[model samples]
Target: MSPFLINLALNFLFGSKGKEVIDLAQRLILAAENAGGSGEEKFRAVMTALSQYAQEHGLLANFPQPLREAIFRLVIEALVFLLSKQGLINTHKRAYYEQPTFPWA
Candidate 1:
């Protein structure tokens, strides 16, 4: 599930469609599984890894500042929703996802 979410995020975040995202997704899945502390901490670790990957790989280099930030936020929201669904987060946080308007609720 983490792999799927990472793949989705990679596609959305970078518009990349290839092996690189697969490799990155594997790493993310491992990181998410092995991440220590509570669920929130694990989530933060994943987010940190994602942000670092974006910066190091220049995923958002072509975008304007505001647009880049917005995209990043959406990516994070999607990630949270995905991870939560996988039981990596507390599901009680959200009732549903039918609207696709709010990431958590």
Candidate 2:
């Protein structure tokens, strides 16, 4: 998904309290970079944060089923794009597009 859609999903997830989530996401991205993980790893780390936020907020229950599914998909797509841009994923080939093998996933 495009970054615009990702931003929209994030906004919806955070509601009017999105600042914390955005700050946390930024910090996590920086931490991932500092840890020297590949872009893919960093992206996965961000995804972990998203998952954690969802669980913590019980976001799924707060939304209708269809909206929840859409947000989930957007989050996943945003992560893929983030990883690809960071060169963590093998964008030159189609290899890393497989299901996330990360421990958290």
Which whole-number lDDT from 0 to 100 does residue 11 have in model 1?
80
Best by TM-score: 1
Give TM-scores for every candidate, taking all chains together and pairing residue i with residue i.
0.49, 0.39
Least accurate stretch of 10 residues (summed lDDT) in model 1?
A: 90-99
Per-residue lDDT, model 1, residue 8, is 77
Measured on C-alpha atoms, candidate 1 has an lDDT of: 0.67
Clashes of each: 0, 1
- Which stretches in model 1 have alpha-carbon errors above 4 Å? 1-16, 61-70, 79-105
**Residue 8 lDDT, candidate 2, scale 0-100:** 86
For residues 1-105, write the lDDT of model 2, one tens digit per residue.
676876787789878667766665565566556656676676566556665667777767778756865786586666556667556556663345554657596
